[model samples]
Target: MLGSLVDNVVDMFQASNVDWKKIIIVGAIFDFGFKTVLDVLQYRSQCRASPPAEITKTGLIDQTTFIKSQNYSKSKLRFGMFERTISLFQNIAFLKYNLLPKIWEYSKVTAATYFHGGDIVAGIVTMLIIGAGSTVVGLPLDWYHTFVMEKKFGFNKQTFKLWVVDNIKSWVLALILTPPLLAAILMIINYFGKMFVFYLVLFMLVLNVLAMIIYPTIIAPIFNKYEPLEDGELKTAIENLAASQSFPLGRIYVVDGSTRSTHSNAYFIGLPWYKQIVLYDTLISENTSDEIVAVLSHELGHWKRNHIPFLLASGLLNAGLNFAFLGLFLDNASFFSSLGFNAGDMPTVVALLVFSDALGPLTAILQLVQNLIVRSCEYDADRFSVRLGYGENLKTALVNLNKSNLSSVDADRLYSTFYHSHPILPERLRAINEEMDVKKSAEKKRQ
Candidate 1:
């Protein structure tokens, strides 16, 4: 099955432009047509294989009946219909204006072969457009989750006042920061063409390092207040643990996490000199300081392993692939003009997303590979925490978190592999158990 899938993907990539478009259209149609079929199949499989199959007081319906009833609901079937409807409206609105075409016409790339000057400017502008447009999509989803879902789950901390303030602050920050960075990208792409990816990768690394230097000290404070872990046993315990590990963290502190949700977490943010582990107050209330230390240690392991660097590299590689593909596809006039973008004035930046959208399968594969690697790192970090003598504490924290957040413990491997950045609860628990055995053996040797 995997081989066939891989072969099909490779063929799609090698296919001619017309073939590629046909494949895209077919994939999109298949994605729409079979959406409900797959969802229903997976849902039914889960339901059938579910634990504790208790014959309840409510009359039993056979699987056939249940399937029929679910199909009749028609909710699953509407997934593509809703998406298509939204896209249709968006196309209609965009089509009414030659405004975008005029803009593209103005920004036309004149370079014969390599990345041109105009292409870079257009690319940067397009990126900003996407980033801005995405913020529009993302902000609402975040708000919905924070205000509605998280609140319903009893996790919210902020008031309407705080929420509004945070949103405005975030938007202002994006506005202040995005344009110049984007402009720099335009300059590089215009000058370097294909070589722009190299510069982008370097720029991203520097950006991440800068963020590491400043995030805990600056950016984070803009949203939440942080105070030193109070003068108490909790503080002393955390400090002692950090000292023992020689972990180069600046301070242990608490954030008012309960203002949003009952779920608790702890994280190490910023670089070593400025590194601070911010524990949710709710975490302090529930888990012992030991567990918090274990959690912090795991987070510290992420830093030590330079996992963020790994993530940054993955992002840059993805961007490079995206840029290359964009260069390839954007040259095709039909894809551009059909989408209401003027081929002549085609902003390289906007065309970037259009190309990415076209290369959807490759992006998905890239993300999937990256996600699988990240999940493995989560296990490695767990082991690192165990080496610091906090394996049990980490396990305890994970259990508590799962309960508080109401996440299922026993998700399928495929589900976790596909969607989870962190390994699922059972897998993590198993890893912790293995680490505990190693710890006991080391202690016996010490004795």
Candidate 2:
């Protein structure tokens, strides 16, 4: 009966002469429009008359810092609005001009000239062309954000020469990596055909694991220098904490994050038995050893709770769903028509992009659910940190991180709930306080 129902639905869908182009364009509009509305809400929240009393009364942030933070938030919001508007127009232009088809044709010619114009080779060329175009489009915005706005807010630490060097390196890396990656994906699609989704998921899972191993150890150090955290109270304390938990600790390195921005953070990486913790040099400078340890306690809590695997699993599920949907559009001639591809000659890459964009609302919905789950994990990690007796220090560290970074403290409930993977600072603090109270009460009972 279920099979019959699904067949009937599919038959109805096929019979319906849906305007695929219109559906895709409309979805883009709503996707961008909805996010714009949320940003506006968040902007309003940031525009509140003053910082929260709890924050100010505790002297976590002075009035001057609060004002700076508010202004910073407002500036970013204004910038975001402009960028989104530009992006919407760009998307429209790309679709209306049949840019993908033009680019795909160009890629085919280039491939024919060089690589013999096989579909897989042409597909790789097409993706690289798109990537190059996107990189060109985004560079100016990225520069203004990094150099102009961030410098205006006193956060940009990178020199112009360094920035230029960084970009050169990034493009070099992309050129080296993208072709083979695109070829692999295209090959899987060609070989698996109808079962591409399953194969793609497995491939992506391998890529994710490789990224986890490579990014911090290999890729990141190319951009920023890292050094051993010299023997110190902070290192000693971190080691002690790890010892208590029987965590397999390896090398502790401090990354020169201050070279680019004043923002601070710490995280752990590597396989289960030989884990490494990396602290941003900025985090060491901005925070006391205890507060830094407290921050890392929360980070380690994530490891303790296996949040990395959970997040990885969630990402796989998301990718699986994405690929499955793309597979449905494989035989979709009308969808190819919408993408400006000849009905029967549709490339997997074109179908992937068009279907992904057309399904924007669905992805946004998925993002909200993912954010909710991630935020819950954050709360749980906070509780774990508190249980480890770092609650007070963690609270102070949170305040300092926000103050240093000029982060917006006030958040619209809807916007925050929909977008943020971690609970806002105030929410985190409140939860930590509640957990502390529980801990203290339990201690009293034990006595």
* Top-scoring candidate (TM-score): 2
Clashes of each: 14, 0
Stretch of 10 with least lDDT, candidate 1? 50-59
What range of 10 consecutive residues in model 2 has the weakest lDDT sum?
9-18
Per-residue lDDT tens digits for candidate 2, residues 337-389, read 76677657778777766777877887777888889879888998899999999
- Model 2 residue runs over 4 Å out of place are 1-16
lDDT of 1: 0.63
lDDT of 1 by residue, 1-447 (tens): 997986675555544344433444455555444443544443443444332122111123334444433332233224434545455444334445544454444444322233365555455444555466657766665676677656654567778888888889987888777767777765666677757767766777788788877777788888777888779877887777777767776877788877656767787776646567788888888877677777778887787777866866777787666665655653455555554653354455655544554665676677778887788788888888888778767877876665555554444445445556777666777778878898899899999
lDDT agreement of model 2 with the native: 0.85
lDDT, residue 46, model 2: 84
